[model samples]
Structure formats: structure tokens, C-alpha cells
Target: MKQQSLALHETMEVHEMLNLKTVSMTTSKMMEGVVFDQDLKALLEKDVQQSIGAINDLQRLLKKAPKIE
Candidate 1:
């Protein structure tokens, strides 16, 4: 039914959001360590930003989707 579909979508949205937040936090913490050099840090930061941006875009799409009810 429409309700079930909406619930599934919402669940997926939350899962993705949580995953993104985790990745963001982990990457941020990793960056705090002085082991990595500037070049590597820049590359890693870019990847983290890309992942966060992708999740944000998905969240935006889910929010914009119209309810079937």
C-alpha cells in the first residue's frame, strides 16, 4: 500500500542519513590525527565531502517525493 511504501522510504532515508553522519564524523576524527600529510588529507576530505553531498541529495529527493496517500 501507499503507507507501506512511504514507511519504507522513510526508513531508507533515516538509514542513509545515519550512515552519512557516521562517515562524516569518522573522517573528521581521522583528520584530527597528524599522521596524514596535506595531500592525503585533501584527497580524503574531498571523498568525505562527496559522500556527504550524495547523501544530502538523496535526502532532498526523498523529502520532495509526494506521498501516495
Candidate 2:
């Protein structure tokens, strides 16, 4: 009976440890995805700003040119 109890306790401990490990891995993956998403958003915003600036510069240059028939 004592040996059976020890085996049962060990099995329970191992099961709990596996669950903890799974949770830890899942959390880590979620954090990594969040970080990647944030980086992508920042890069997209920067690209948009650059495009707007280029358009404004082009408009200004166009305004400076003399009109020709």
C-alpha cells in the first residue's frame, strides 16, 4: 500500500509539472507574437509617414514650376 501511494504521488507531480511547462511555453509564444505585431505596426506607420512626406515635397516642387502652354 505504501509503495502504491508513492507511485501515485510521483505520477501526480509529473502531470502537474507537464501542465506548468505547457502553460509557460504557450505564454512565451503569445508574447513573441505580440512583439512581432508591434514591430510590424511601427514599420507600417513609418512607411506611411515617408510616403506622405514625399507627396508633400512633390506638390511643393510642382507649385514652383512656371506654367507652360
Candidate 3:
């Protein structure tokens, strides 16, 4: 299979999404320490897990993106 590099705009959008997900995951992880409600904590944990998967996928896609220099 031929591997194609991502377009500049698509690369930028993916990068932005990766950053946002990273921030969200970080926030959720930190909140897990202070959160008292079991249900809320569980929800945050789930979000963190999903974000991790998404970040991994984004990283793989980024590997194919053209160099920005």
C-alpha cells in the first residue's frame, strides 16, 4: 500500500485536536485526585481512557504528515 502524507491543513487540524485532547486528559487526571463523587470520577476516568486512544491514533497519523520546515 502506498503511504500518503497528510495535507498541511489536515495536519494542522489534527495537531490542534491532539493538543486539545491532551489538555482534556490532563485535566481529567488531575481532577480524579480531588473529585469526591464516585460517578463523576468514573466518568472522568472513562474520558481519560478515550482521550489516550484518540491521542495514540492522532500520533500515528502525524507520523505521516509532511515536515513543517
Number of clashes recorded per candidate: 0, 0, 0
Task: Indicate the worst ten consecutive residues by lDDT in candidate 1.
Answer: 1-10
lDDT of 1: 0.66
Model 2 segments beyond 4 Å from truth? 1-6, 36-69
How high a TM-score does candidate 3 get?
0.92
lDDT of 2 at 68: 42
User: Best candidate, TM-score-wise?
Assistant: 3
Every model's Cα RMSD, please? 5.3, 31.5, 1.1
User: After best superposition, candidate 1 residue 52: deviation in angstroms?
Assistant: 2.3
Name the 10 consecutive residues with the lowest summed lDDT in model 3.
Answer: 60-69
Off by over 4 Å in 1: 1-21, 64-69
lDDT of candidate 2?
Answer: 0.51
Please report the TM-score between candidate 2 and the true structure: 0.42
Cα deviation in Å at residue 48, candidate 1?
2.1
Residues 1-69, model 1: lDDT tens digits: 443233666767666776777677577658747645887777767767777777776666566445658
For residues 1-69, write the lDDT of model 2, one tens digit per residue: 422222444545545654554555455544554565777656655555554555455454444444447
Whole-model lDDT per candidate: 0.66, 0.51, 0.96
**What's the CA RMSD of model 3 in angstroms?**
1.1
